[model samples]
Target: MSSKLFLGHRLRRLRRDHQMSQTDMATSLAISPSYLNHLERNQRPVTATLLLKLAEHYDVDVRAFAAGGGTRTGPDELAEIFSDHLLADLGVPRYELAELAHNSPSVADAVARLYAALKEAGRNPSLASNDDARSVVTPENWVRDYIQQHRNHYPELEEAAETLGGALSDPLSMQEPMRKRLKNAWGITTRVVSQSELGNISQQFDAERQLFLISSQLRPENRTFALAYQLALVEFAGVIDRMVAEAGAPDEGIRQLLHMSLANYAAGAIMMPYGRFLQACEEMRYSIDRLCGEFGANVEQVAHRLTTLSRPGARGVPFFMLRVDPAGNISKRYAGDQFPFSRFGGTCPRWNLHAAFQAAGQVVTQLIETPDGHRYFTVARTIERPIKSDLSGGLLAIGLGCDIVFAHKLHCAEAYDLADAPVTPVGPACSICPRLDCGYRATPPAGRMLAVDRNAKSISPYPFLP
Candidate 1:
């Protein structure tokens, strides 16, 4: 809680709004022009004396001079950017990078954009050696960026699914109704076949015979979901095609992946028709287990559908969902809000999501705060994948969270005191986390020089140089 302030961006905005030159403002405040320039550029902090002077001279609120009103990019983001292997040899200091982000935001943004482009290019084998061709982007990354930019919600797909749901007798119990609709509307028959008969495919459709085949090894919920997904593909193909066309996906592979994702989205919408699901969520206090039981869906499906409740005028709680294996590898992510997630590295191990694996199939809840001071209420549980013959089944942990402002409405937060709860400070990843005192930290924060002492030992393995 240091009182030292860094309000350079705010001060620059104020001066520009009033159309006052730095020299004029410096003369009015009785400070040198160079000193004023330094303050505006974040080269020097705004001291308490200068803060009072600005408040009195400009007739503004003193609270405006408080810290935390400067940069849009957080220190963790800058840390991650500077930690890139390409810039590792530079050995830049963390405070310097923070200053660059606060003082020169546009330059910081350009660096971020360039880094993203390079990472995307580095994924392709052909572009690895061509520096000039690094600008060429991949269609898979383009589609992922498109989904992220849209916040994982598509109103058009929701509307289409709702319209289709209207034709069914019961949209929530969509298995039987969807089956009837497929048979009557599209003249397609669905059959549950043995794994040996179905070969390697989990699902297949025969156009000539007008038959849909699903492997019998899938769990009942998965079987139903597969059926719903197939119905979406057949019924909402036009809508999915239009979205993919508008996205301008370059390759057929990317197009197919986009189509599959859109189909899954539509299937979720159909299973939990937006309006009914929103009402159920409100009544149940956002309990995933209750929603699953009521809707006849599994926990994973319930959590995934929670992130898609972003319809306008009838929106539910904004949630972020992520799936990671026991090894800490992220398999799926969908954010309906601005929850910063690590893009290239493992998530913070301090999060209870990783601990959910120890108590498999049980839900764990936690109150976590990011380095930027935003707090969230998260619940996690482990999901078991279906086993197939000689292949072993795997487990993935699913985490669902919402901002702390909306925590009181969730059933998971009932046992804890929202106002007095002890929050676990978590970061996007270990590489960028600035929490020096965390006992479980595996690596020193990027851009900081580690001070290792052989003769004199401390609790932390790598004490950062001041």
Candidate 2:
């Protein structure tokens, strides 16, 4: 709504792509070339009227830039990427990050992505590719960034899933229909087997026998999801391949990972179609439990699905979902809004996502204010792990949140006084958190000298210069 945008690079690119000089573009827009140069160089911000005119003449969707689209990187993410201890000594200025994000977004995104790969490689050496010619970014991070780049929404996948969802006679019982479709249409039989038979795997498809076997120990929601996943893979195989090809995946490993993740996304979409699910979400006031019941999805599934409701016209609350274990490892993340998520580090100790472990399966609510003074309404709950973040299906918790402005739309937020409610001050992580008074700080803020003293001590374990 505000005209405080610095999208000069985009305008310049548009003009260059159209093979028009500054003078020509300015003449077309009824402005002087000098003024156009100012806008192109980001010396002046574009006004609302100019933006609409550019959209009308050049056919640019101005909303893409406003919605943090066109590129995966943002100024905040650039700031966080440079805040790493590895680059802390460089002391990259804040305005430089802004300039990089605005002027050369593709380069900024590549930098952020490479930094992510470095972190992942440091974390898991076994997964890192030994080939020198190959990309440094891991397949996991590569595919994850691809999903994040699209905001975890694929229009083609959503449409295919809608067709799949239309074939479902009952949403309450999806396993039967998904199984029937897989068997009757694709001639792929579905069987629920024991974990031992599947060798501790959640699922296995025997191509020779045309069999899809799911572990009996797997949750009902997961079984349904697996079936939907299989159906997705079978029905829309070429579409997924084309998507992976378009993504420019470096290797077959990344392509396979993308295929799996995209199939999972499609499965989730099939389980919860866009229009029907969005209507149900509105009618039920975005209640996870009710949506779970209506869609036959688990809490995590419903919460994850909620993040994908970023469709243009029927946009729902822009929520971010985070899955973390007691050890502070973040396994899953979907940021619908700029939630200031730490890239390489764990969540802050002050956040109650970890506290959700105390009451397993019970949803806990909190209104947290970040150091940036942005308030978010968060709901956290514990779920059975069955995940790699914690081996042996140990304790794992997930937190779902949205900007405080949309908090009132949530069913859980109805119990709180949004205006007068007490808000907790939380940071990204102790290593980067600037809060000095907090005793729970495990490490000092980056680039700050610790205020060591012989005769006195501060409340924080890692006291630093203010």
Which one wins on lDDT? Answer: 2
Candidate 2 per-residue C-alpha lDDT over 257-355 given as tens digits, one digit per residue, 9 for 90 to 100 = 889998888989999998899999999999999998999888888888988887655677878899987887787888655556675578877788989
Q: How would you encode candidate 1's per-residue C-alpha lDDT over 1-466 as one tens digit per residue?
A: 8756776876786687569999988898899999889888877888888878877777544542363322334455567877875686687777888777666766765575566667766666567566654335555455555676566879888887877766663645767888888999999999989998877778888999999998888877788788889999999888898988887666677788888888988888887778878899999999988998877788889898998776645667888888988888777877776655675567888889999999998989999998878899999999877425456447889999988988999988999999999999988777777677676778876667887788987676667775
Top-scoring candidate (TM-score): 2
What would the TM-scores of all predictions be? 0.77, 0.88
Model 2: residue 203 alpha-carbon error in angstroms: 1.4
Query: Clash pairs of candidate 2?
Result: none
Candidate 1 yields a Cα-based lDDT of 0.77
lDDT of each structure? 0.77, 0.82
Global CA lDDT computed for model 2: 0.82
Question: How displaced is residue 334 in candidate 2, in Å?
Answer: 1.0
Kindly report which residue stretches of model 1 are placed more than 4 angstroms away from their true locations once superposed.
Answer: 1-79, 88-141, 169-172, 386-392
